[model samples]
Target: MMNRILLSVSGVLLLLVGTATLLQPHAFFATEGITLGNDPGLLSEIRAPGGLLIGCAIAILLGAFRQSMTQTPLILSAIVYGSFGLSRLLSMGLDGLPSSSLIAAAVVELAIGGLCVVFLLRLKPV
Candidate 1:
């Protein structure tokens, strides 16, 4: 149903992004028009969140398959994506517009967060 679709899409997207960011931080930033110079410290910071994202992605996928376990991941999805969207909004307010890719990402994050909220509302606790 809609819940499965949301989880599947979010999980796959997060998994791919997490893996890419973890494995190739420089390349990932390059795509975003940012040069992640050869700073070990900066790379470490990026990789840290990337690992968490990978874990979240796995949880989402598991929830998608195990209907009884969907609640937690759906809640997580709402929190994480909502936070991302809000952060992006804050950044825009403070620093002005970023690249097109970043703006697009913000839009997607907001939309996904909204979808999570809607799905969670519709879902009945087991």
Candidate 2:
């Protein structure tokens, strides 16, 4: 099902991202630095998100393994993707310099979120 694919893709993305962050937070920060926007301890927050992403990725993979994809998982994944894209858009509009990579990421996130929503709508009662 599309839901399954969405969940798996999100899981893979998150897993790789988390691995990248866990292994090379410095490299990521160097490449795409964040200044906390008047908020303190931004580095700590950046570090914290990685752990959450890794955990969610693992859970998603497990859910897929059980062939248990459903609205809950798909919706949650969509929320994550959509919120991230929305926040990035807002940040770019209000603050933080936008780069090609940032724009590309936002586009992909929005696309995936849209796909998840469409699939959720198309799903039959179960």
Best by TM-score: 1
TM-scores for every candidate against the unseen true structure? 0.96, 0.82
lDDT of 2 by residue, 1-126 (tens): 556777889889988887766656777656766433424476567767888878878876665566655667677777878888899899988997588888999999898888878887887778
lDDT for position 83 in model 2? 89
Off by over 4 Å in 2: 33-42
Clash count, one per candidate: 0, 0
**CA shift of 80, model 2, Å:** 0.6
lDDT tens string, model 1, 1-126? 778889989898889889988998889889878898888998899999999989999999898888888888898888888898899999999999999889999999999989999999988767
Report the Cα lDDT for candidate 1: 0.90
Cα lDDT of candidate 2 equals 0.76
